[model samples]
Target: MLPAPSRPPRLRALAVAAAGLVVLTSLTGCTQIASAFNGLQQNAVSTPAPRPAVTQAVSMPYDSKFTYDGSVSLSTDVADGLEVRLDVWAADPKRTQEWAPDNDKTFGFAVNVVDHRVDEKAVLTQKRRVYMSMISITSQVSQSTIGQQQMMSPFQFSADPRTLVPSDTMRSDRGLLLNTFQGGLLVPTTTIHQLPADTYGITLQFALQVWVEGTANTDTSFQQQTVYQVLPIAIFSPTTPTQ
Candidate 1:
């Protein structure tokens, strides 16, 4: 059996938020969204999660916006703490533009879709540290081993196991937020796609690429592991697009 995640209070909040998201999604007719990781979780020295602050952006007329539920945890390998850290990424205001700017834009990221260009060259330093490799796993009926399963539609991504801090320094532009943009007026999260009602559950894998210290981690090992929550995905189109 795998060890219980030392999820912090903030992470719990996000987990709850993620749950709430599923409920809200039901209103629009969604299904349980889950992740199936195709890797092994190592038993290394784990660290505490990170505490995130919240911020929101609203429209007076549209009544459209979201709240950032800042919740993250810090995992480590070295005794002192995590040696290498995963670089941070800020709100990509131009994300929609990169893909179909004229296709009606919204400030949010979603799972199972990579419409945006996803600036592979963009890099930003986080205020605190990046916590990743947060995987969700399931145990066998009567076995002392791990399960082996693959996601139906796995999004290819790379992330470092631990947070990183440059020994020397970096450029303002090349810092964490590549373009010096602050986090979204709300929190940046993965939006789930609704599935058919006839389906009991579907496997999903969300990948996040991290630049441990350089451009980004390319290996599939250091990425976050474990199968996350198994919940419903909220399905809804943008009520109204913001110009």
Candidate 2:
């Protein structure tokens, strides 16, 4: 094997100088790189949180036979708003059980959509419809010591554009009012749920969702409103009728 050639002094010195320059450059660039990373972290932390979405809740009166008559309306700055009304009545089934010999038995309630409308301003940029997609009813009953009984999706109430009809106002005006929609949601008594007895407190909750028109490329603006009413129910008891 041939002996390794010894490096020239000038070349060795030049190599040492290059190594020193690399070390110097690394040391100088470290602070700038760290500062850049820190700036990004700070900027990320300083970003503001988003605003909360719009939601409204209203309470309704209680009826032993699950009857409600009310309306809820909400307005916005952009001329897009929603209005809903319901007048429901429960029929006396006159159902009799061996346990209770009474004639004031109620089977279920009937839903009469008094009025539901969506008013919006004209948006020439995009085409849209004031769509009322769904309606839900929730029932809850509380007893003295038996805890509480709640049903999240009790009474399946469904509505759509087909269930609604254009109002007289919308017919009078042409394309000028592209955002107005009006109709009623009528639910038959067959769709309602039967009431149970021997409960301290009973409540019925109603909710509806609507899709409002928005910008062409952006997602639609959704608005939902929920309202509940207390149900005055008197439990039938042979031992104690008021119980």
Candidate 3:
């Protein structure tokens, strides 16, 4: 009831202005809050999602045990029943089972020429003959980083095949007769020194120079030719302790 006393006009006006300022401040604060919330929402919508990580595949080393005691048979369309058989194996079977690049390795190979058209019991001169004059082997190693690496042979073997034969047999300038009274050629073993550290596989290429008779009845019509054979051996990496 005491407030019924009339207030001053200027004071009334000042009170009205203060009330309007409070309302304007409240509206401005609310608008700022709303604008901040909308900015956050827009940022969330515009941002890109993270990408996934990439991984590469790894390859395993080759195993030597797979090729031991393997034989390769070769023949040409020019001759029927004339086959050249090659048998290859590790000199030390136990050691080669775990072949490594640092250690020395030896391999053995045998070459046999067979003429199925003639009797097995026939004498050397009477059968279709294949004379082996030269035997050579070249090697290559497969490496992951270097691709293919060429290697030098530890030993060189070049001889007349007939020289290895018995003195009782008749010798000919043509070379050693593979299909003879005896069996085929046998190379006990050829040693290979240490290879590149990263070698995973080894390839041995065998080249044989030979004189093959055109007819089974006579050796006079012999023609010279070269025969090639490839043999692959896997190599293992040196073992290391796991971390």
Candidate 4:
């Protein structure tokens, strides 16, 4: 085995918030709703028979107005037999659009997602980090345009992993919200003009990329991997208040 780092390698964590806009208009009152698959999960790790391991699925909201809390749980296998567990959610005030002339025509969501990993056999010799690759949105119910963009890139701290001791339990986690805007609001120059007030079915796609340290002792030996997931969101216009 290659020699370990002079000092214990550090753990690296990442968080991302991605936001985009697409116009949708309701056509009919009879809505064909798709039930939110609460706790949607997929296993990409080990396929061994259940001798003592247990599997569980968590549920997330499927239908709601904009700016509400929505969550999706994740558990997947990554490079070097590492298992990752995390959750993804849309930030509160999921969408914001003001009608004031001075107000910027903007809307966004704070979709936070986190990923942590642990090697099954304690074989990790270096740090591990995961990044939010991309978030996509599409509206088939309104016949609108599709929107997708890379959330955030890995940064300096994220490139460095937290130390992992040989005898340590071997676990770490990082958090991020995927959005194009900062402070949960798009920049003044952003072209995302408004949020649709129509009832429609929308699909959101999320992707994650991971980098795992290798025991080869060379920088080139680091392993890189990616994970992808798709989720559904339902939108309904707020009811007008009685005067």
Candidate 5:
């Protein structure tokens, strides 16, 4: 014969146990699926892209040709019997960087009494002649421990800094040494005149000096080359009487 029928209370207890199991599964879903992530992953949400490279501006110790159209009027007898005057013009970015004593000191294109040719006896056949300049290049790089706050390109190359003396530096002897140099340079006004006019096929070769301490680190050098030629002009004869 069969056993007695199950009680209602016994059925109710079985239903409650089944409901508890379902609740436990819902609360701990990760625990059951832990094995699915055995191979782990580690990555940042976002990444920065690499920047493109840039090229720096090349300067002295590497010779380059520049064209000029400057305006000036020279007085024949000035600067201890030399023709001296002023010029207002533009120079090549490369060349201006080469001549400045301190590149940051200025970016102005001005004039000076930079040339002198003696007429001793044989004077030019014309007066008021438009002149061409055969400039010799001098450059040096100064490197002082830049204060952490320093900013901008600190190199200033200029051929005529002595003339730019603010009233303060006018009487200074060491002013040129302190003010007119990268590390140090001695660009006498005569350097421009001494350049060879041997006519390397109608080109005037000027001297270029190697500067150190700025950016061209090693014992750098600038080779001799014809940088520029002047535009020809006819002027009143230098030998003409002062009418």
Candidate 6:
């Protein structure tokens, strides 16, 4: 056969360079695709699962004439080895059912003290005896209007709790002796009058001042302390019927 026409040196060199470029381009494309797939796999393994949403419930006001639970019990162990209990209730359930804004509401309450470290019968004579000195109630309304009056007290109460007890009971400047033979002290009822016409709810805060006996069982080495309790009342709308 006739000698094949020899390709020029320049043309042969160009063909070799183009083949190498094609191979390099193919390898670079495969590398890029592998890198992208690996990134996706890593994200799938490292990502956290989605979480559920959370929500809260809201409290609504009660009807003014509705006869709801009027009693609440509160206890405090703030004093060492002493447990103070407070029981509060509507003075008259019937009256509570008729309660409305711009009217009076009455409440009854009692206070009792117990010593877990000692017997109930001996709490009075024990060194850990608790005595009541003063009791008071302060009020706050949920809502108010211009010129609407606030209530201080429907009737005045003695700042001294001892006055509420019988004279035959143990006498001390510390106040009224609690853990008495009778069990506890009761305030029959107190009225709150002329609430703000726009009030939807009322909160009454009671504060009790007491003296806790120290290490001495016979002598009056007492430390003063206060116990607090709160009561919330929902007022019915004047136009709404009992429901």
Candidates' TM-scores?
A: 0.23, 0.35, 0.62, 0.33, 0.17, 0.61
Tens-digit lDDT string for candidate 4 (1-243): 112112111111112221121111121210111011111111112121222233232223334322232334445665554444434334322232112112222222222222233432222232333323222322222212223221121000111111101112122342221111211111111111123333233444445454444432244554556655544444333432111
Q: What tens digits encode model 2's per-residue C-alpha lDDT throughout 64-88?
A: 4331111112222222332223333
lDDT of 6 by residue, 1-243 (tens): 112123345324333432232222354543443343333323321122232343332235643222364455677774678777776656543345455676666565566666777665564556366777887665666543333343433223335655544454454677766653423465544555555456566766778888877652755567888888766777666654454
* Candidate number with greatest TM-score: 3
Computed on alpha carbons, the lDDT of every model, listed in order, comes to: 0.23, 0.31, 0.53, 0.27, 0.22, 0.54
Q: What RMSD does model 2 have?
A: 31.1
| Tens-digit per-residue lDDT, 1-243, candidate 3 | 011123235334333432232222344543443343333323321122232343332355554432442323334322577876665555543344456678867554556666887786677656777777877665666654433333444223445544443333333576665663434554444555566676677877778888888787675688888888766777667652111
How close to the true structure is residue 22 of candidate 2, measured as C-alpha lDDT? 22
Model 6, stretches more than 4 Å misplaced? Answer: 1-67, 95-97, 144-158, 180-183, 216-221, 239-243
RMSD of 4: 20.3
The candidate, 2 or 3, that scores higher on TM-score is 3
lDDT: which is higher, 1 or 6? 6
Please tell me which model should have the higher TM-score, number 2 or number 4.
2
Q: What local lDDT does model 1 show for residue 117?
A: 21
Candidate No. with top lDDT: 6
Native-to-model Cα distance after best TM-score fit, residue 53 in candidate 1, in Å: 51
Q: How many times do residue backbones clash in model 1?
A: 26
lDDT of 5 by residue, 14-45 (tens): 22432232222342332322211111101111
Instruction: List runs of model 5 lying over 4 Å from the truth.
Output: 1-80, 86-106, 112-130, 146-243
Write down the lDDT that model 1 would get: 0.23
